[model samples]
Target: MTNAADRIAVSTWSLHRMMGTTYPHNLDTLEVGPVTEAYGPVNESLLDIPSAIANHGINRLEIVSFHIPTRDKVYLGELKSALAAVDVTLQTLLIDAGDISDPLTSDRDTRWIASWIETANELGAERARVIAGKQKPTRDALDLSVKKLTELADGNAGSAVRLTTENWFDLLAEPGHVNFILDKLDGRVGLNGDFGNWGGPTKYADLRAIFGRAETCHAKASFVDGTLDEADYAACIEAAEAAGYKGPYTLIFDANAPHEWDGIAAEKAFIEARIG
Candidate 1:
């Protein structure tokens, strides 16, 4: 039988600061410079993450594309073996930073996403998460996103890895705009609902409008002075359930906790207590 906790996964991004020293969030496009070279020859091993999460009883992972130190097949194979050793499911490979909204850059962005899809396949990941766009949400941008995303999906036909996007960046700031693109793509792409991505008075209402379409969730909790806001966390869960969302709640622990695992454990417990 699958335990309720089994349905939960932890994203490597939750440990971004902990995994290694600071570098650009978009490590994929780093230019030749001190910041770039300092990040070169990754000091941290991606291999350690899977087993670390398994130690906390979480058996799934969503790896950020930038965190992948090397794209060499051998290194990926070793990472895949590490996950299997700990029985961790590589749920999604998050490909951050790109703008398919511009016609000038759409082709390059599409090809970049395709490359991650290939890497996701190599790592046995079930899906890859790409940023919708950093550009302002306009009709033209939406159309371009649809075109590039469709091309990416069509290009990777028959691959086991699927594609997903989050309610993130400028273009996806509003739920209506998010729905517009998802509606156009139909089911060609998936949504990875995130709690902290959108906030303010209408956050829950916005989430309610789209949670049902979520294939997975980045269950991020807000923290103030290193303490979590339970009221907001509970409401986020309520909103998702009311919207009929029934998908894995990947605990996203981004806080100033002394230990990353503590934040993860608390978030996981909070979600399980509310949902289960």
Candidate 2:
């Protein structure tokens, strides 16, 4: 009975173009530069997102922390109730922006990340993701990541949610450094291996190397002028499976579709057909 559909989840970031700008935290707020210039203002509310995912045949979801309009307990309860009503699992709470690499801001950023982890616990997410870093993978930066991530992980002990990081940002672009940080953490943190974050000729090789340690995957497909690259998409799946990655394929649809839901459904079908 188990198949790829059972292992699929959807990320709200995929529908960033449609998720209206009601929430205070902008997706581009933490980026190095203004990158969301092309996307339209948010058009959807968090209250409506859960049912939307369920309607698409996906029962699991990974929500970007910023997309949440409020941290009030009442709102959080509402979101939880909505998901429970439809039997959807809040798989992961993605804490999108934080740079534990900068010593000057490490204290402040780590505290911020810890705050999100607490929210993830309150929201009943199974796991939470924090960005690894934006700095180069230097010894000092890696050491700083170890210290801050350990602190954040230790705080989550005895909580239902586990902490995770992606093979994302400049510091974690390579598998060697990715392993270095994970090995140093010694299972304290998990990985959210992202297919689109890493690219180039060696992308597949890199994915295979790091995905074995992945607790989940950001199964993103590359697009050119709104067209999906089927070859690369399949290869990313193959590499992940080859490395024994058996976690949920968190579909991240970033292409141009008339309706965000249609783009998400198309991705789910693509994955199901290949893995079925």
Error of 2 at 41 (Å): 6.1
User: Weakest 10 consecutive residues, lDDT, candidate 2?
Assistant: 26-35
Model 2: how far residue 77 lies from native, Å: 0.6
lDDT of each: 0.83, 0.84
Q: Name the 10 consecutive residues with the lowest summed lDDT in model 1.
A: 31-40
Each model's backbone clash number = 0, 5
Best by TM-score: 2
* Candidate 1 backbone collisions, by pair: none
- The segments of candidate 2 whose C-alpha lies over 4 angstroms from its true place after superposition are 22-43
| Model 2 error, position 249 (Å) | 0.4
Each model's TM-score, in the order given? Answer: 0.91, 0.92
Query: What's the distance in Å from true for residue 263, model 1?
Result: 0.8
List of clashing residue pairs for candidate 2 = 19-42, 20-42, 20-43, 20-44, 21-42
